[model samples]
Target chain A: MKLWKKNIWKNTILIVFGIIILLPFFWMFTTSVSDPLKIFSEKLRFFPEEWRWESYREAVSKVPFFLFMWNSFKIAFLVSLGQIITSFFAGYAFARLKFPMRNLIFYIVLGTLMIPGQVTLIPLYSIMAKFNLINTHWSLIIPGLASPFGIFLMRQYFLVFPTELEDAAKIDGCNVPKFLIHVALPSSKSILATLGVLAFIGSWGNFIGPLVFLTDLDKATVPLGLYRFMGSYSTSWPELMAATAISIIPLIVMYIIAQRYIIEAYSFAGVRK
Target chain B: MGKKKWKKSEVMWGYFLIAPAISIIAIFALVPVGYAIYYSFTDYSLFHPPYFIGLENFKELFADEDFWQVVKNTLFYLIGVPVGLFVALFLASLLNDRTLKLAPLYRSIYFVPVILPMISIGAVWIWIFNVKYGLMNHFLGLLGIKPIPWLTSYEWSKIPVIITGIWQGFGGSTIILLAGMQNIPGEVYEAAKLDGAGGMKMFFRITLPLLSQSIVVVTIMSVIASFQIFDLVMVLTGGGPGRSSASIVQFIYEKAFRSFEMGYASAAAALLFVVIFIVSIVQLKISQRITNY
Candidate 1:
């Protein structure tokens, strides 16, 4: 009986804490669709009493919603594709190729990781200004196309790959890019997915890069787009939350679809370091 | 050394493949770092050409009370790391139970905050933290407590910012720590159970001690992350009623972008680099030492 009680207690505690952790999200969601008057009422219920979801339509029409989403989508997709290609290419060179000064070059690339992004912010802004690229998406996309971390992730994987395959391909007269395209890529699908998903999520939700690089509301990504709405309609909690929900709903859907790869791969590899 | 003849195609392909990545890094990452260091020693407005002043920026930064206040606030923000970790560890321990049938479902719920943009988090939290007619004070009223100022007062502003951050942050750490927990072999628990170790005893003696490496790694990474906090702070309190809640990076942002004081901002950023670099080195050393454990 004591053990049964303890087990019950443990389960109850877990359920309660989970609810507490989820309350803010619940509040955000419930408030988004609730009436504006009820949102301001003294007694705010946890769940919405009515679904006035034109708030979604209202929020969407308030600004360039679709344009913001498109910019976000374009940036995230290009960043993922760009990082994957570049990281794979660089990773193979660092891992498999026996060129002179390979180790030295690899270390040099990795050493740049020590410099925090803040240290580079001022000069990057200046460089972007020099080239008249400050307000352009190219400024955002170019800086993110390659990262030492992504290269390191790929290089680590390729380092332990079977050398016999490489030697076999070499003796078979298989062309270099062809081997990577057919052989290496097929083997690295999961790791590549891990990188792609992470890159996509990071780029989609990014605020600082867009905040610094892009100035126009039309050019803004989703997060800053929502923020721009908030500045104007700070009093309208329902509309703001509705906009907020719209921004993250896509990411949430993707996360659910790929939770298996994400939690397992990311916890061990991508985000931790 | 076995002088195996290198394939002409292989060496040429290597350079060809790496060219794009190398070019991007050279222009964006490498050059920016060099220019930042140079700018730190010179005075340059947005319009004027940079001129050498030789530590003028650094000297002004040391005496600036505003700079120190931001440094103090950023350090204060570090309190969120350990607090968030404790909650995450507790939650992970609960989720560690084998009988928890819906563990994955529950974990996904926890991780939702981590994947959301800071702007979304800020938008939701701002209404919740509202002084009058807010969800927080409404709850306080239900319990017969007075509504306290959450985001307005200089004294109490950091509390709400830290709480929101913890809410967003603890989830990711919980997920990581949960993965760490599973990595421990099942036999250790069995051995402990055979020795008649109680649940509490096993947690302290077996679980925590074994999980210390992961705990340390997560904690150090959290420290590094706390330094770069910007969008969240901007949304939460806008660094507050009078700069009481501004972070180090926010300080840099205001100086560099808002005021266009490139030299002063670079100096502050240089200091930030030193702080993070030191923390990162400690992380590297500690991580290397703990890998075998």
Candidate 2:
């Protein structure tokens, strides 16, 4: 009876804590649908009586929502695809290839991770401006294509892949690309998915990249588009919340779809560090 | 003959495979770092030719009061990291109870905030911290407590920012801890139960100690991330109320972009880089010791 009593108490505590933990997001969702005036209505309502769906409709119409989505999709898709292809090949080379200065080059790549990206922001901006890449998706996509973290994660994953199989492939007269594509690529599916998802999620939610490079409203990503809705003098709380929800919903959806892969990526990133 | 040539081509291909990565790092990452370092020693605004001023920028920064204030705010935000991380780890352990029917749903729900862009989170939080009609004030009112000026006052600004940060952040740490929990052998718990250990004792003795490696890693990452926080501060406070809540990064941004003091900004950036480097090395050394034990 004491043990059972303890269990019930523990469960109640967990339930209460969980509710507290989820409250902010719940409130955000509620506020998104609630009327601006009704937000602080003297009689508090946790749930809105009549959902104002127009906030979302107005948010979509005010900004080029589909264009922003397309721009974000294009940038993220290109960056992720390129990052996977480049990081995979480089990871394979580091993990399996015979070459002098391999470890030295790998160390250099790892060292870059410690150097904060903020240090390079202005210089990179200048360079991109010089190349006339500013206001274009290439500015964002090109730099991210060679992600050090992806390379590092992929290298660690590739290192554990069986070398004997590669040797067999070579003996069967398969070349490097052939061996990598036919044997190595198929085996590293989980890690690749993890890397791809991580790269996609990061590229999707990026603000600094689009803020610095993409000056045109039509060229801006979701974060930048949302920024347009905000003003220095005042803010549209309900509309801002609506836009915020819309901007984040796709990421939330992607994360939900690939939760297992993302969880594995977190472990991979955490332990490998 | 063709096979011999193919072997040679394969070796070259390996080098070719890494060329794009090396070039990207060299052009984008390396050059910027090098330029920033160079600019730190010169008196260069964005529009002017950089004149070599050799440590003048560094000298000015040593006496800068605002820089110190920003540093203090950063450290203030950093204090919440360990508290938040451990709380998340605690949450993870509870949800790791497989007997719980909705563990996956609980984990995903907790993790939802982590995936959201900081831009959006910052927007919602700004409203939440509004002095009047804000949810926080209204909620606090229910208890007959006076409303707190969350972002308006210097004294109160950073605390609210830290709260928002903790709310958004704990999810990532929880997920990582959950991953660590899965790797531990189930038999350890069984053995503990056989030895008459209950929930609290087993958790303190076994689960936490076993999870220490992951905990250390999470703590270090969280600390680094917290110190370098930019977006939330940018949107919410603009590091305002007389620079009381300005962070090192925001200070650097103002110095570089707003004030156009590129040389001094670079010096500040370099100083920040050194400070972060030292902190990271110390953190790594500490984590290394934990792992070794």
Candidate with best DockQ: 1
User: Candidate 1 lDDT, tens digit per residue, B16-120?
Assistant: 777788888888889998999899999988989899999999999999999999999999999999999999999899888776677778788788788878888
lDDT of 1 by residue, A95-167 (tens): 8876656678788788887777889988999888888999999888888898787788889889998989988
Q: List the candidate 2 regions with Cα displacement exceeding 4 Å.
A: A1-10, A232-235, B1-10, B186-201
Q: Which CAPRI level is candidate 1?
A: medium
State the interface C-alpha RMSD of candidate 1: 2.0
Q: In candidate 2, which residue pairs get closer than 3 Å at backbone N, Cα or C atoms, i.e. clash?
A: none
Candidate with top TM-score is 1
CA lDDT of every candidate: 0.85, 0.81
Is model 2 an incorrect, acceptable, medium or high docking prediction? medium
Please give the RMSD to the true structure for each candidate, in Å: 2.3, 3.3
Q: Encode model 2's per-residue lDDT on B157-256: one tens digit a residue.
A: 8887788888888878888888888888999999999999998998889888888778877887888878778878877787888887888888887787
Worst 10 residues of 2 chain A by lDDT: A228-237
Please identify model 1 stretches exceeding 4 Å from their true place: A1-7, A233-235, A270-273, B1-9, B192-196, B287-293
